[model samples]
Target: MLGVTDYGAFVIAFLLLLAIPGPGNFALITATGKGGIKGGLAATCGVILGDQVLMWLAVAGVATLLAAYPAAFHVVQWAGAAYLAWLGLRMLLSKPGGAPRTTRMDSGQYLRQTMMITLLNPKAIMFYMAFFPLFVDPVHHQGMITFAFMAVTVAALTLLYGLVAVLLTHHLAERMRASPKMANLLERLAGACLVGFGIKLAAMR
Candidate 1:
């Protein structure tokens, strides 16, 4: 429907991709853990907005430009990796017994931060560009309708995944509140993972 072929397969593939642990998921879980459900939701919205922007850019053929310019692609990749590493380092080095970082951030800040995180990752743009065409029926393409459907599907799935991550992380946060040490440890671990992701992104060719 909507000029998309194998809708079921598309949904399954998309969900599987989402399920993979990535910087986006890490940000969601970390935000929720630090800022509670409200913070988590704000981050989620930011990510969704970022994804929409990237998808549209892909549709506009930015992906071709990226592929044409290896240097440009590497620039974005390095920037994204650096950004993730910076965030991870901050969390990793944070001293315990202080106010949580989430407490200091308003909704707007969370939104902006997460949006930047999503936008800086060039891999996401590549993924959308590569994956979107596979499901699009060129012969039956209905322009806006097909694009809109795909956009909405991604947004909906992201929302569901974000909500689940927020709930689960919030639960864990609640338990961790009673033990500062454990909370600190978990935060450090999350930070480490973020750093690892940054390193991985940097290593990607």
Candidate 2:
């Protein structure tokens, strides 16, 4: 487990997190619908790479530095809170059914677009910076090795989730169209969760 406590819970938590509706999910669904399996797969690759980048940057920097200057950790917490709250508000205000935005036939285009979105994704970094530490056994932490293991675990989980999402989205494309309300409800719920997380993170201090 590489210093990760409750490894099973970590995996389960991540898998459940993936189940939540979000921009990345929409991008995958849209890519599949517009460009088929190839495009969806390409987008999936993009998401994995983007998440890897975000994960390393946060894990190596924030987690490392924060342990030293614990006070400075508040900055990250505040930033995450503001960012999450903003995103939640935006999602709440957005006309449900709206996605992060996409539609491309070229695999490369889908990859690049999704990668960029994931790179700038608020939820990605917020979760990494704020949520990751919860499971870290600081006393048993193995520095980079621990972070690396977590990163790999995250990447592998994302790949599995993306593959399943692509296949399911492709298969459910028609039914999804028929049940647009379900998508809207998910968005609303996600927005609520984001806001709740933001408040909770802010209060943790």
Candidate 3:
């Protein structure tokens, strides 16, 4: 278990966190729909990498520093909100049949886009900082080793969850592809949901 207080409990908590609907999940689904399995896997990698960056930063006390500076927190929060809204607006305004699409080969684009989305959310850092302590063994903690283990666990969980999502989304995408109008409507709905998510994020205190 290393520095983990209870490995089983930690895994359960982490899985629950992942189950919560969020921007990253939506991005993964959207990428899968557009670029199939390859794109979903790329986006999954992007999410993992982005999360690793934040996890290490949290361990380095960046979360504490941000907490001490309200302005800095607000800046990141607003930036993420704006980015989501902008992407949503673009999707909303695009013509039904003319919207740009990507293929399975566009792995890089999916990866970067999802990474950017994950990185811009300030709340994610707060969550990581809070989350790590809950499962950390204060009496026998191994510092970096403990955190590293937790990071790897989360990443593995994410990859597993993402694969399942990709398979489901790909199947749904196939059905939608045969119905352009339905696809267009669903695309519009996704855009609106993105906008709603942004507003909700921005409104959070």
Task: List model 1 lDDT by residue over 36-110, tens digit each.
Answer: 899899999999999999999998988889999999999999999999999899889888877656568877778
How much is 64 displaced in model 2, in angstroms?
10
Name the lDDT of candidate 2. 0.73
Error of 2 at 65 (Å): 10
List the candidate 3 regions with Cα displacement exceeding 4 Å.
Answer: 101-105
Counted clashes in each candidate structure: 0, 0, 0
> Candidate 3 lDDT (Cα, whole model)?
0.86
| Model 3's TM-score against the true structure | 0.95
Error of 2 at 183 (Å): 14
Off by over 4 Å in 1: none
**Candidate 2: Cα lDDT at 195:** 76
**What C-alpha lDDT values do all the predictions have?**
0.89, 0.73, 0.86
lDDT of 3 by residue, 1-205 (tens): 8989989998888888887888888888888878889999999999998999998899899999998999999999999999888777766775777654443338998899889889989889998998899888899999889998999999999899889989999999998898877877877777788888899889988
Per-model TM-score, in order, reads 0.95, 0.65, 0.95
Which candidate leads the pack in lDDT?
1
